[model samples]
Target chain A: MKIHIYQIAITLISSLMIFKGFENYIKGKNGQTVLKLLVRIIVWGGMVLIALFPRFTNILASTIGMEGNINAIILTGFILVFLMIFKLLSAIERLEQSLSQVTRNETLKEIKKED
Target chain B: MTYFENSKIFIVIPAFNEETVIQGVIKEVQSAGYENIVVIDDGSSDNTQAKAAELIGKMAFRHKINRGKGGATKTGIEAAKLLGADIIVTIDGDGQHDPKDIAKIIAPILEKKCGVVLGTRLLNPKGMPLWKIFANHFGNFCTWFLFGLWVTDSQSGFRAYSKHAAELINTRADRYEYDSEVIREIHLHKLKFKEIPVAVRYTKYSMGKIHKQGFINGFKTLYKMIWGLIS
Candidate 1:
């Protein structure tokens, strides 16, 4: 069994990311939702698994009907990036709406106080 | 005496960093025979609130944070509702709208002709710039396409709403798109609306304001309106 240096580096980075995700959840920062934490953990866990088992990439590529492992990885990366972008955009829109509502309610409350 | 003389007309001025023109706008509205003025200062870093507050008989409410013009206008509407307003007239704090037109805008509502009355500058766009005329037409077209409601000046901030219309037309947009959203609300609620030709004052100061409607904001507003429909 030959272990590549790149595999070691990838596993190390992925492990650190997984740990950080848990740490953030524990700290209750960013209003982290359970579903968000689960998604983060699953993504990082999959990265760690792929780095530890290089042969799994071949299986994944074959299962996905891709010609090569690199192609499979690139496609998956693009999908993940786009999905994350969409999720972030939705979150931003929700936050903006909430902020506007809060500002409006506060302004109205002050007016009520004056009256 | 005018038809709306007996009605409690609340002039809602949604201001954002308009310290330079807040007081003058309030005075103009005051001189226009409207005393129940509600100035919603949308979290201006300047002295817009103080200037508006200095004017007697004007109720000034400041948002702790900058909520776009739509948000401020919504707050003004809600405050006016609480203050027992029979008719609410929203005017830009930048002083672009003629305060004298307040009477004309609210007449349709007082006459029971419509639930909502919009002041259109396109009919009498005398001093309006060529670019503004084009932009307003584009906005009107977009509002028609998106909201299925068309008016001469869909982007006009100077509008008068009867208490029923004001309470019924709840908007979700917090920016320029809110103007279009009001059109959607009018269509959805089947509220009778009238567009009256109103004079617009295009001054160097108003045109110079970076926050006023422009090319980029127009596209952003269009995108937001689409997004709102989808989401």
Candidate 2:
């Protein structure tokens, strides 16, 4: 029945993020796809649940056949971080290619103007 | 000389921040009987564009942002193609490549011996730094491993492309890996390519340029080549 300071902090942060995600979805910012919005909601909602009820992680760990809840949480956090990093890298590479193409086309267009 | 008179040879010099030597490099290419010079200033913060523009007959195109050497070279190639270039020769803007050898590299293309002529410095690497020689060989090995085609100097920027070859070899790399990509294009398209010995001038100024590919860049180029293959 004891509520720790860390638990309150995490719940507050996750709730704020969840509210912001829904607000953006309502405002149609970044062309928010349904699947993207669903994923964001699931991730933030899961964090809020875990912060509010630390015992939920024990159930998750048992379902995943893990001995300890801390190990399960750490492993899932690492996987999520790595997936986000990979996605960001790929996106950056795509943006770089687009920028190069635009610059190249503009330079070539100047030749046509001169002729 | 008569062959050059018949062909519209465009000398493409892809430069980035080479303000001190752009004019000299332009003059050298001009003195070597190549009047159609296209200098692609790859978003240089210095006076490279202004210096190149000072030369009346040469064409200077500026990129709104820096896109590395490969991007600049590709832009230059595209511009040269639009300008009706029959034979396009790409040279470094740092004056490291001798404009005198332009005739030698383009001879094979002019004679219809090959669609692409690669100027190899390894054939006669006199006055070339020892470390550069080693790095070039490593680059050649990496190119062979990644693309399954090998040349003496896969990293050499001094090259000549016939109109047909230039039109066919469309590369996607926007960095140093572009040279290796050209080799891959040659392999994939079955374009006839000839490698000939060409002279390289390594001066204090060229050696001092920060943009030159060093130990770290070589690995980065290799990584990009592999990533291109996978993605």
> What TM-score would chain B receive for each of the candidates shown?
0.97, 0.97
**What is the TM-score (0 to 1) of candidate 2?**
0.77
Mind giving the per-residue lDDT tens digits that candidate 1 earns over A77-112? 887797678778778888998999888787777557
User: Model 1 residue A85 lDDT?
Assistant: 88
TM-score of chain A of each: 0.67, 0.72
Off by over 4 Å in 1: A1-80, A113-115, B1-3
DockQ of each: 0.47, 0.49
CAPRI rating of model 2:
acceptable
* Clashes per model (N, Cα, C within 3 A): 0, 0
Tens-digit lDDT string for candidate 1 (B91-183) = 999999989898899888998999999999999999999999999999999999988987999999999999999989989899999999999
**Per-residue lDDT tens digits of candidate 2, residues A1-115?**
8988988898888788788888988899864777667877788788778878888999999999999999988987987797578658767777889999999888778567777
What TM-score against the true fold does each predicted structure earn?
0.78, 0.77
For model 2, the superposed segments whose C-alpha errors exceed 4 Å read: A1-83, B1-3
Q: Residue B140's C-alpha lDDT in candidate 1?
A: 94
Provide the fnat value for model 1, as a fraction from 0 to 1: 0.80
